[model samples]
Target: MTPVLYLDFDGVLHPADVRVTASEPKRPRVYNGGSTNHPLLEHAPLLERILAPFADVKIVLSTSWVRVLGYEYTMQQLPAALRERVVGTIWQGELLQHPPRTRYDAIQSDANNRGVTRWLALDDDTEGWPDEQRYALIAPNNFWYGLAQPGVADELSQALALLCAGKPLESRLPQETHVPSTVERIFGLG
Candidate 1:
């Protein structure tokens, strides 16, 4: 079976805009994002590259942004032809108000209803999954205002391979420890 792929906006697919915009009601040099067409929009080709190995996968979006706005707005970032390839969507309206225990559950529920298994989720906020099952690709900083680097999508693809083989994905940066040993380290954590 082709795995189901859960697509997210924000850091996973879209990059946070670090630039200040004139339309802002207040400040300058402030950034905004998780919405589509941020600079990370340049990275979308990564999605097509990552999903290529899966023969029958279905694409499902788990982004709350879509629900907050709507398809019309979301589609603005894509070329007309690219938008046509999207198959199914789960809007923010379809979700429970409190973030759930499984972003996987959200995706899995959609996959189950569609009778799909072998799924992959790409998310910035994986509020739905418990700590142990955080097997999907989670942005390292755990913040919404960043972007995935180029290799990340490849690692996510590798993780899907690992999961299908009944193995867990080790940190792609296994040698890189994130925890800080001192309070001074905490200051630079972001």
Candidate 2:
């Protein structure tokens, strides 16, 4: 079975709160408050670097960008290396006519249709993902950091290694650690 990675653009490659102007629908801009002002796909190089050694791994677009911007336009946004790895997209033709409820559902349906037994998803949306299949999801929960978040690249690399090795993906996402406000920190209450 060919190893597949379901890639999300909004929250995986860049910040989740991205906006595209009516005049420039193809150009996506990030609006993640004032936390982190990362350019679109600012972490693309990191992702590209991680996947460089795994030449056989294929990518499947599971992002809403493909639905909103069209497949070709969305594909153009990726760097050459990542773009070349894209085998297909989840939002096209029949799937577009009848879209899935959640990202996980779309990927699951696509994987089953393609007979892909070894696959994982790099996404931030965890709404409909079940606990049993959580092992296949590498979630960069912080919208501001996305793939740049600490340990996310490592998690993705490790997952890809496991997938290529034909090993069961059993790693769960690390528990979130809370960062206290400055006030709490100063008062030693955190």
Candidate 3:
């Protein structure tokens, strides 16, 4: 079975602390992102290089951008190398009208519907992911810094290899500790 990589754009492709413009958002000054171009396109080469060896590996969009830009447009935004590897997105058009409780559940629902067993997810947010599913996630440094962090790419590469081998993907960093409810944020009640 071809391995599927669930990719997030905001934090995975570029830093989450980015500025949005009418044309294209401005990416923050990343530490080692290879390029200082648009945030979305800057880290394309890095992802390309990491997945180059795994030719059969496919990418499934797990980013909120898919809801706004649509799959075709989002695919077009990716680097040529990464674009060719994209199969589809986790968020189907209709589902956008009614999002799941968590990002992990959304991806899992899509993967299950597609019968995709061998898969991995890379993102900065791991909120709502159960412990078992957390094992497959390669959480980024933080929202502000992504693969720019030292050793991030190496860690991602290693995680990819392990996921491809069907081995458990343990979290090196702490899991999403806790996610407060919307009411808590709104009313300041825990």
Quote the RMSD, in angstroms, for model 1: 9.3
**RMSD values, in order shown:** 9.3, 8.0, 9.6
lDDT tens per residue, model 1, 1-190: 6556677766665553323345741221224533333354555766666656654555666765555555556655554444544666655445545444666667766766767655666776555566555665545343443335645655677776775564545443355556666775777653
Worst 10 residues of 2 by lDDT: 29-38
* lDDT values, one for every candidate: 0.56, 0.89, 0.77
- lDDT digits (tens) for residues 31-116 of candidate 2: 75633456888889999999998999999999999888899988998999999999999897778989988889999999989999
Candidate 1 C-alpha error for residue 34, in Å: 14
Candidate 2 achieves a global lDDT of 0.89
Please count the clashing residue pairs in each candidate, in the order shown.
7, 0, 0
Q: Report residue 14 deviation for candidate 1 (angstroms).
A: 2.2
| Pairs clashing within candidate 1 | 3-118, 67-92, 101-128, 102-128, 102-129, 103-128, 103-129
Tens-place lDDT per residue, model 3, 154-186, is 888887887777776664445666677999889
Candidate 2: deviation at residue 151, Å? Answer: 0.9
lDDT at position 83, candidate 1: 55
Top model number, TM-score: 2
Alpha-carbon deviation at 71 in model 1, angstroms: 2.7
Model 3 accuracy (lDDT, Cα):
0.77
